[model samples]
Target: MPSGPNSGRVSRSSGRWRWSDATRETTDTPTAATLETERMKDRYGLEVSTSSAEARDAYVEGIDRMLSAEAGVEDCLAAAIAADPGFALPHAALARQHQLYVRPDEARASAEAAVELSHSATARERQHVEIVRLLVAGQVPQALDLIRQHVIDYPRDAFALAPACGVFGAIGFSGRIGREAELLEFLEPLATHYGDDWWFATVHAFALIETGRWDRGRQLAERALEQRPSTPHGAHTLVHALFEAGDDDEAVSFLEGWLPDSDRASVLHCHIWWHYALVLMAVSRHDDAWQAFRHNCLPGTTTSPPITVFSDSSSFMWRSELAGQPRDRAIWQQVREFYEERFPQPIVFVDAHAGLTYAVLGETEQLQACLTELQELGEAGRLPAGTTGATLGQAYGAFVDEKWSTVIDVLEPLIPQVVRIGGSRAQRDLMTNTLLAAYVRSGRTDEARAFCAQVVDRRPTRPVAGFELC
Candidate 1:
């Protein structure tokens, strides 16, 4: 179905976007510096803040505003930059906005400007935004510049160090691991300081979960939820914590209630859809899971390129598998090569999950490599999700290798770990279902029975994980 002029829009001008000539509610002569600020308040209704925590909030808020199609986020970012031209992020934000809109020159200029602006930022803050700017621009070399800087100057900035945790681990990246023990040293303090801030906590959660602090990550996520109960991210983190802690039943019940009342939309909608879909998939509702995927993809079908306009698309795509479907092959082929070659350094979740769609297309090698990298990340404490790339692959490997013990042994520990370390209870459904299959197939009826009992304890309302495994 084609969207008539306003499918995903919140505001429009006679069915066309009012891009430049914005409507303003104020009459003050716009300062050249704050010209964008006046336009921002007049058009989108956002406030300016210079504090670190507020910067994080503004980032999310600006992204939200852009999602609403109110005014381009660039409007508010302009205002932010006007208020404090020294702030690296406002310029970085504009660069990102330009990159998304496909203004290459502007994007490059903005990224360059971010570097120039960073001179005034604290070593930690400069290191933080530079990689992001490079990452956003797809300039991996420049991104790597900051990576080297992270290793050398002010190496303790949590944001800069977390991604560096797996730089060498990436199959395509360059480096030899010299004393891998250092990873823990770098991540511990970062995770400790990041306990309450949502984004910091999220990054730290991944760091913790990836490094094997499943219980700790869950606790931190709980702390994150306490900080901002209504923020979608907090809700997202809470779900992962519950699911990983082996509470799938509550996870499902919680999401089922939340989705109807979620009553809001943003770039993170895909996370919601995917999370819900995972719950439905656990309950063996394939149709509902598919619907969730479709909902996340709707904007992509209607739009193009960068699909950040829909939040859940990123998470949902990474979480859901698509081997049996015909359309999935088409989706895989269309973007697989581009993502594989084009992205300088892959966003692991995106690359790993996207690569899995090719499992049946004889791209098992690609999938295997992705899974290997993910396994390394999980083992080393970089990929907090503990998402076994081939949830089925582990069981199949155990079966074919006649190591039934491996299947039961491997999956038995993983179910709770997944729930505990992963971001939300909603996300852990995939783990529970995967473990249920692996346990039963490995011919460990005793453990499977225990799993059956354990799975139900999480959510008494969910039907027991029956003998059918998956």
Candidate 2:
């Protein structure tokens, strides 16, 4: 019965149970928690007086309630960050929202603003920039130190330790994140304090999937939906797990039956639907998968999105691989220019790493400079989030050289870690699949078969958003 605002349909083996049957109960039971999670008002008022610590806690709690429930409230929170110009929480909220929308610069700005506005922005938010910077610099040790320090300071805050997980995952911190207590500590208490916090449960579910505890992931994801709020993090994790677990029919049922209406949801949560598209493609439904990407980034086919979203490496990779056709090279040119606008260099990884795209485009000097910059940062520890990371560097190296096997070999082992750190499952899959197809084209099928099986096995089990088999 997972049919909340974000719930996909839930089905039972027995024909005896149906959604209509579940909805037959006349009046829906309205509760305070439900009300709290559904507060979509755009008004900004500090109703909770902050003279006392209790009032501050209440104020924070009220804001958290709205943010957790309503998507539009994100703009409100961002405005609040602007309005106060000093409160740390609004900045954190704005940063997180920016991150969700795949706007890394916005996220970085918000995180930095949070630290600038408050000296006590908590060790976590401060570490955000520090770790990202170190990752960009390619100084794994220095980056880990900053993240490890946060672990000691805010041992109970998942937000604090979560960055370490990302650092270790995407950038390769010369350590195993799954074995890191810093990450476990963050996740453990989150599952405890917010046992009811579906967002935290999403993280927990991902951890479970990583550990091969599929049953646990399934259970946690179900529990997450039971506590569904406005944001679809829980739904993203839940659907991903179901798909990964080979519950394709159930995943589809979940999406169509319980899925929320997607219009005006957010222009940037492409991960949400791209995930769904991956699952659908996995189940051999190319048509459905194509529609997912089209619905996501394709412009003004209305029920179609504005085309502005498609101009990126990530988006084009999707268009190339899953559109059940060859890539539109014209689109690639447009996307390349668009990516350039978003990632003008500052010695960042995405840009430096993206130099491979420049290399592919025959901009030899740009590629060489990007390579030189990337190596320097990786060795010295100067890059920031969305910039320096071992995986990005390694992938870029092989990518620039056109060494398909190296890309696969280097990236395969890094997948679980990067996803754990929230490096983005959709992005990683795009990179991996791109490598896989290229390998096949090079007549390296024997090498790629194992990897393709892994992709087929893994992508569905860890369901992405907006995808379902037709």
Top-scoring candidate (TM-score): 2
lDDT of each: 0.47, 0.48
Worst 10 residues of 2 by lDDT: 41-50
> lDDT score, residue 290, model 2?
67
User: What is residue 278's positional error in candidate 2, in angstroms?
Assistant: 1.8
Per-model TM against the reference: 0.51, 0.61
Candidate 1, residue 121: lDDT: 63
> How well does candidate 1 score on lDDT at residue 150?
70
Q: Where in model 1 is the C-alpha error above 4 Å?
A: 1-75, 82-87, 93-107, 118-185, 191-202, 210-215, 257-267, 297-470
- Tell how far residue 391 is off in model 2, in angstroms: 8.5
lDDT of 2 by residue, 1-470 (tens): 23222222211222111112122211122355654543211112112111222222322433433333334545445444443455565565566556544566877777666656556544454555455544444455676677666655444444434444422233333333444334544456544444344555656776666444657877877786675534465666667677557777777767665445643454324545665665666666767766776666433322211222432234444434433455555545555665666555543324323644554455667656666665566566555433334455456556546686777677666655544323334344555555555465456666655655655435433222222222
